[model samples]
Target chain A: MALLEIKNLHVCVGDKEILKGLTLTIEQGTVHAIMGPNGSGKSTLSNVIAGNPVYEVTEGEILFKGKNLLALKTDERANEGVFLGFQYPIEIPGVSYATFLKQALSCKRKYLGETPLDPVQFIKRLKIRAQALGVSDDMLKRSVNVGFSGGEKKRLETLQMAFLEPDFCILDEMDSGLDVDALRVVGQGVGIMREKCRSFMLITHYQRLLDYIEPDIVHIMINGKIVASGDKLLALRVEEKGYACYK
Target chain B: MAQKEIENIIDASYKYGFETDVETETAPKGLSEEVIRFISTEKKEPKWLLDFRLKAYNHWLSLKEPQWAKIKYPPIDYQSLYYYTVPKKKKNLKSLDEVDPEILKTYEKLGIPLQEQKALAGVVAVDAVFDSVSVATTYQKHLAEKGIIFCSMSEAVQNHPELIKKYLGSVVPYTDNFFACLNSAVFSDGSFVFIPKSVKCPMELSSYFRINARHSGQFERTLIIAEEGSYVSYLEGCTAPQRDENQLHAAVVEIVVLKNAEVKYSTVQNWYPGDKNGVGGIYNFVTKRGLCHDYAKLSWTQVETGSAITWKYPSCVLLGDHSVGEFYSVALTNNYQQADTGTKMLHLGKNTRSTIVSKGISAGYSNQTYRGLVKMSKNALNGRNFSRCDSLLIGNKCGAHTIPVLINENKTAQVEHEATTSRISEEQLFYCEQRGVNPEDAVSLIVNGFCKEVMQQLPMEFAIEAGKLIGISLEGSIG
Candidate 1:
């Protein structure tokens, strides 16, 4: 069974339609990349899957692990092992990164009918995962993403994905605004998280991210629909052809 | 915001609205010279005190209730309120055990145990004032050993008359405002603390005020004096029982910090905030101020989450050279509640400094406002003041306002003010939710973070409780 299945999804932001008749599926153990131009609905697809209320799913069916994902709230989808790496991470002024992650992890544990991690164990696991993502201990102590540079914010997002260990991860523009060194670090972080039980969907406008973590399948999205589908060669082709043919 | 979501936020009921079933004595329902005389006689106050009350009574009679605050309410019927009431058993109680069991249970229900054994250990000394009098004061003996005079205001009148006479109404004169004059005339009981020169208080001193008598107005007076080179930290918590009629609570708090002394005052006010339609609740109008002498410091931290209509400004006066003043506050108004609160920082001495941090959260149909004033006198060379006020609106129906006044009379004085009003963004909420936190908890986390600066100023023990109060006040604010 597919880890994530979207059938004829239609999403609208206010009166304007952003995602029109979009359909895709990702099986377990596969990393699928979606390449699209600006306003091509790549970010909208990730946001709709995360159940953001602003983007109304006018008509759609989202199935995750054979369950109706659209009927669930954002947090419920998260508890079911679905993650959306935000394109723009928010700056919550007073909430420390450590505190936020602990509460998030506790919520997931409660949903899974498992005992919550004690403070000692929680801190231990957080430090270990954050270190792997090259996140400084000082960053965790600071307000969540407040005053973080572009690279620091992306690294924090990857660190969160690593900590949650979600079964299906959606990286939305995760490679944007990152320097080459930072991009390599974030890519390697994602590369290390790949497992047989997990699936990933990388959404981006460029194919440079694919050079670090190669994709099993790449799809081209244009004008709110997937126009083409192929393997890794599709991303390379777009990088060279500049999406003029798809237009 | 959906109608259902707004309804849920409005239905977040008050948890500390249970009445104590205790027999009580109450004064006649009226305000007059006779009422003031009656109260003075009942407490066996000195002639000077009675004279002071009479002067304030005449002054109060000539003044009208101020209507300048950004809050609306039907005119308060001062004549219809019982000016004084006390539990009958309080006159004969010799110890905590001898006090009324129902009263003890009431405090326990409010998460404050009155019994010495079950109380919040030695870290805090509490003076629990119920209705019109202090019922039980814990850790008094321990505090007394440190030369820290902590007791009921009525007791201070009898035991430390000199100190009370010298500092009472000194910071906030009796004729400062209409409500302050009323409180001076009929004030019943509140905590009084005095730290002698060079003495550092060993534990946090606290006063818990509970308004229990029906139709009874609670007028409490608190006075704290930190002598030269002394230091103290004080906390105050207040709650009232639910009733169908609005209750009047007018209080006056004054603190004096002498040369090189320091004092920290914190208040967590969780009074009943009325019903969904704003039928009944407390009209909390208070005057709290402090004066800092040479090289002294004074800080005020308050978390206000209750009262149907609140009009209070806890202020500081930097009167001495190199003195410092700070005000940190988090005021939340939900349902039909209204709050107009902030602080005043006056720099009169050279090189004096002050800081103000105010955060307001408005939910449901409530309105929250931050009104502040920062003034630096001409002689205040190199004086500095920084003020920041932030407002967070939960639902679309509520309102948040910031009104700040800055007066810099000296060229060398530096004053900076920043204010921002924002709603909890959908993206921020979704980000938290997508991390597995529920919506309610997500709101709490973001709000707590928003008010972190003020919360950090609170003492460790009170900080925990204040955080919980913030969460409770914002319950159901999000759909």
Candidate 2:
């Protein structure tokens, strides 16, 4: 069975329908890239899968590991080993990154009936991950995402995902506004966390991000539906030519 | 004086209704020269102290309760409340263990475990006062070893009479205001702290005041003096049981930071607020002021999350060159609570500086205001100050206001003031809920984020407690 499967999903925000009849499935140990132009319901799909309350899944069934994924709350989904690297991370002042990350990690542990990491052990783990990601000590000490550069924020998100060691990862345009060097860092971080039991869905408009992190399959999404699917070369074709061909 | 006839005013129920009647020593219920004399005589106060109280009593009769604040309540019957009450049945306990069970239970109900455990280990001493008298004070001898005099105000007059005659009424004079005047006259008991020169207080000195029973007012006086090059941080918390008839609680606090010394005073006021209809609650009219003498500094940080009606303005006077002043506050009002509180910074010394940050949260039918002033004297060359006041309204029925006054007479002085009012946006809440957080948790996270700036100013131990308090108080604020 696939790690996450969606069958002919229909989603709406408020009274307006956004995602129409979208079907996709991803097995473990693979990276799937969803490339689409703006207003093509790419972000809507990402948000809906994350259980964003603003988006109503009018008609669809999302199954994760044989369980109904639609029944889970946002945090519940997070606790169930699902991680969404947000495109625009929320800036929560007064909540330090260290403090928030610790809570998120322990929240998952508590759900798994495991003992939470003590502060000393947690900080020791955090320092190694943060150092590897080039996240400065000052940045980790500050309020989460408050005054963080775009590149720093993306790297921080990836660092959190690495710490969480989720079974499935969703990158919602995580490469936007990132320079080539920062993209390499983020791509490498995601590459390190990809194991046999893990899967990923990279949602982006441009195919450039796919160049750094090669995907097993590339799907072209348009008008709330994936119109075409192919292999690695398909990403290059779309990068050279645009989504116009798929349209 | 006897309990006056109950007036048929707005009848409301108090929410924090609990009381303890112990074998306490109390003067007659009234405010008169004879009452002051009786208190002075009971405490064995010096002739000068007695004369001071008499003069303050005469001045208090000449003044009226200021009506400038936005709080509304019935008039206070000063004659019907006991001005002095002390536990005559005590054998002078050494710690909280030897204290009476009823008094200990009162503190415990208020969540103040006066134990020597790590949770409350940092607390240096406590002046646990009930109604109009102090019941117990801990760790006086340890503080005394360092030449630090920490005791009740009345006890200070009896022990350190010279210090009382000099500094008493110097920072907050007898005629400072109506409440201060009244407090000076019939002020029965309060904490008196004196830190000698170049000494850092070993631990935090705290005072917990509880108002039990109805129809009785609580008038306590607090005076803190940090001598030259000394430092101290003091905390004060107050609460009262619920009642249907409005009760009066008028207090006066004064701090003097001598040259090269610094004093930080923090208050977590959770006085009993009347029910939703705003019936019976404590009329919290208080006057707190501090003076930063030459080359000294003073800071007032408060988290006022309770009170049916709160009227206070803790101010600072920068009279010494290069002296500094700061005020950080987070005032949350729910139900029918009305709070009109802020601070004042007066700059007289050259190169003096001041900073003010006020965060007000209003829910239910409450009203919260931030009224402050920053004044720079003509002789204060190169004076600087920055003030920011922000208010967050939780519901449509609440109101938030900011009234700031900045006066600069010196040409080189710099003054900046900013204020903003924001309501809980539907978009923010939806964003959190989309993340699967419940409505209440989402609201609390956002509110905590909003007040992050002020919360950062608190000490490490207090910051955690303050954050939890904000979260708990904001529960049910969102619909």
Candidate 3:
């Protein structure tokens, strides 16, 4: 069974339709990349799947692990092992990164019927994961993503993904603001988390990110629909030919 | 988000709204010279104190209610309120166990168990004032052993008359403001603390005030004096039963800090905020100020989350050279409540400094405002002040406002003021929700972050309580 299945999804922000009849599916142990131009409904797809309240799911269905994902709220979808790496990470002024992650982890543990991690073990795990993502101790002490540079924000996102260890990860333009060195760190973080039971969907406008973390399948999205699908070559083709032909 | 869902999220009933049934005695309903005399005579106050009350009464009759605050309320009928009330007791209890079980239960329901064994464990000395009388005081003996005077205002008047007489209206004169004058005229029981020179207080001193008598106005006066080179931290908490008729609560708090002394005052006010339609609640108008002497420091931290209409400004008079003043506050108004609160920093001494941080959260149909003033005199050479007021709105119907007044009399003084009004961003909430935190907890996290600086200033126990109060106050405010 597919890890995530979207069937003829139609989404809108206000009265303006952003995702018109979009459909996609990701099976377990797969890395699927979606390449699209600006306003091509790529971000909208990720948001709808994440159950963002701002984007109304006007029609169709979203299924995760053979369950009706549309019937749940954002946090429920998250508890079901679905993750959306934000394009622009928010800066919460007073909530420390450690506190936010602890809360999120505790919620997931409660949902899984597992005992919550004690503070000592929690901090131990946090330090190891933060170190792997190249996130400094000072960064963890600061408020979540507050005053973080573009690279640091992306790294923090990677750290969160590593911490949550979601079954289905959605990387929405995760490579947008990262420098080459920082991009390598984020890519390595994602690579370390790949497992036979987990899957990922990488949404991007360029093929450079694919060179770091290879994709099993790549789809081209244009004007609110998937126009083409191929393997890694499709991303390379878009990088060379641009999105003009797809439009 | 469904309108019904938003209503459900915001319709959390007041948790501390249950009234305890007990026998009580109340003064005649109305304010007059007779009522002032009645209050003084009931407490058996000294002749000098009665004269002070009479003088304040005459002055109060001459002053009108100030209309400068950005709040709307029906005209207060001062003539209709019972000025004083007290629980009927056979005699004064020598210990906590002999106190009225009903009053003890009331405090327990409010999460403040007054049991000797269960008391905050010597870490805090509490003076619990129920209605208009001090019921039971804990850790008094321990505090007294350290040469610190911590007791109810009435007790201080009887036992420590000299100290009370010296500092009673010294920091905030009886003529300070309308509410202060009214409090002076008919004030009942409140906490009083005095730290001797060079003595750092052994533990945090606390006062928990409750208004229980129907139709009675709670007028409590608190005075704290820190002698030269001493230090003390004080905590105050208040709650009242839910009632349909608005009750009046006018309180006056004054603090005097002498040379090389430091005092920290914190208040968590969670009075009943009335029903969703705004039919009944407390009209809380208070005057709290502190005076700092040479090289002294004073800090005020308050978390206000209750009352139908709140109008108060905890201020500081930096009167001595190199003195410092700080005000950190987080005021939340939900349902149909309204709050107009902030602080005043008067920099009169050379090289004095002050810092103010105010955070206001408004939800439902409530309105919250931050009105503050920072003034530096011409002789305050190199005086400095920095103030930041931030407001967070939860719903479309709610409102938040920031009004700051800055007066720099000398070119050498530097003042920086910044104010911002914002709604909890959709992206921020979504980010948290997507991380498996529900919207309610998400809102709490973001709001706590918004009030991080102020919360840090609070003691550990009070910080935890304040954070929970912030969460409960904002319940159901988001979708």
Candidate 4:
């Protein structure tokens, strides 16, 4: 069974249709890369799947692990092992990164019917994961995303994906604002998370991110629909062609 | 979620609205010289105190309620209200056991057990005031060993008459304002603390006020005096029962920080706010002021999340050279509640400094305002003040206003003010929700973060309570 299945999804934001008709499916233990130009409904699909209230799902059904995903709220979708790495991570003043992640982890644990991690125990795991993702202790102490550079925000997103250990991860332009060195760190940090046999969807405009994390299938989205789906070579193909023919 | 669903959640969410039923004594349903005499005579006050009350009452009769605040409510009928009420008791209790079981249970239910055995030592010494009288004060013996007088206002009048006569109404005189004058005339019972010279209070001194009587007004007066080179941290919390009719709570708090003394005052006023339509709640009109001597410091941190109508301005008078005054507040109003609260800093000493950080969160059609004043006298050379007022609105209809008045007579003084009003960032809330925190909890976290500066000013234990109180006050504000 597919890990996530979206059938004929139509979404809108304030009567302006963003996703006209979109359909996609991701199986377990798979990496899917979505390549799309700006204003091609790629973000709408991700937001609709993540249960963003601003995006109204006019029609269609989303099935995650054979259950109706549309019936759940944003937090519930997240607790069901779904993660949406924001394109431009929001800054929350006065809320430290460590505190935010702790609450997130506790919510997931409670949803799984498991006991919350003791603070000492939780800190131990946090330090290990944070170290692996190259997130400094200083960043963890600072307010979430406030005053952080682009590379820093992306690194934090990678760190969160590591800590959450989501089953299905969606990286929405995760490689947009990263330097080469930082991109390597973020890509590899995210690449290693998928080594545990989890599924992921990487949305990027370039094929550079594919060098760090290989994709099993790459989908090209245009005009609110998936235009084509192929193996890794298609990403290289789109890179050379510049998406002019896809229109 | 539908709009009606959100309204349902907000209207039905008042966890601390339960009323405690106990036999009580109440004065006549009117205000006059007789009521003042009745309150003073019932407590067995001396002639001087009665004369003071009569003078304040005469002054109060000539004055009218001020209308400068940015709040609206029906005219309060003072004549139709109970002037004073207390839990009926046979005699003064020597021990906690002698206290009424029902009253003891009421405090216990309110998360304050008056019994000494229930709480570990070195945490807090509480003087519990119910309605209009002090029920019991714990850790008095332990506090008394250090030459500290931690007792109720009534007890202070009896045991330490000199301190009561010397400091009572000294910082805030009876004619200061309408509410303060009313409180001076008819104030029943509140906490009184006198820390001796050069002694640091061993434990936190706290007062818990509960208004269990219906249709009765609670006018309690608190006075604290920190002697030279002394230090003390005082905390007070108040809550009232849910009633369809608005109850008046006009209180006056005065603190005198002597030369080289330091005092920290914190209040978490969680009076029962009326329902979504503003049907019933407490009218919390309080006047709190402190006087700082040479090299002394005074800080006022209040977490006000309750009360249907709040009109308060806790202020400080920087009197001596190099004195410091700080005001940190987080006033939250929701569901038709209205709050107009802030602080004032009067710099009279050379190089005196003051800081004000106010965070106001308004939701559910409520309105709030942050009104402040900073005045530096001509003699206050190089005085300084920094104030920041931030307001966060949750829904579309709620509003937040900031009004700051700063006056500097000294050319060397520096004053800085910054104000910002914005809706609770949807991006922040969505980020939290995307990370598995529900909308309600997300709102709470974001709001707490918004008020983090002021909340961090609170003491450790009180900070946690204030955080939770903010969460509860914003319940059902979002779906």
Alpha-carbon local distance difference test for all models: 0.90, 0.81, 0.90, 0.90
Put down candidate 3 lDDT per residue, A113-194, tens digits, no spaces. Answer: 8998698999999999999888888899899988888888988999999988999999999999688997898789889998
Using TM-score as the measure, the top candidate is 4
Error of 4 at A59 (Å): 2.5
Name the runs in model 4 displaced over 4 angstroms: B1-12
TM-score of 1: 0.97
Ranking by DockQ: 3, 1, 4, 2
Candidate 4 residue-wise lDDT, B1-479, digit = tens: 42322333233377777888788989998999999999999999988899889999999999999999999999989899998999888787878888889989888888886888786456888999999999999999988899999999999998888888888888999999999999999999999999999999988899999988988999999999999999999999988888898999999999999999999999999999998888999999999999999999999999999899999999999999999999999999999999999999999999999999999998888999999999999999999999999998887778899999999999999999999887766677678889998777787888889999999998898999899888888888877
Query: How do all models score by TM-score?
Result: 0.97, 0.89, 0.97, 0.98
CAPRI rating of model 3: medium
lDDT of 4: 0.90
* Interface RMSD to the true structure, each candidate: 1.6, 11.3, 1.5, 1.9
User: What lDDT is obtained when candidate 2 is compared to the true structure?
Assistant: 0.81
* Superposed Cα deviation of residue A54, candidate 4 (Å): 1.9
Error of 4 at A53 (Å): 1.6
Angstrom error at residue B42, model 2: 5.5
- Candidate 3 ranges with C-alpha deviation above 4 Å: A244-247, B2-8
Let me know the DockQ for model 3: 0.73
DockQ scores for all predicted structures: 0.71, 0.19, 0.73, 0.70
Question: If you assessed candidate 4 against the hidden native complex, which CAPRI class would it receive?
Answer: medium
lDDT of 1: 0.90
Model 3 clash pairs are B9-B476, B10-B476
Better of 3 and 4 by TM-score: 4
User: Residue A137 CA error for candidate 3 (Å)?
Assistant: 1.6
- Lowest summed lDDT over 10 consecutive residues: which window, candidate 4 chain B? B2-11
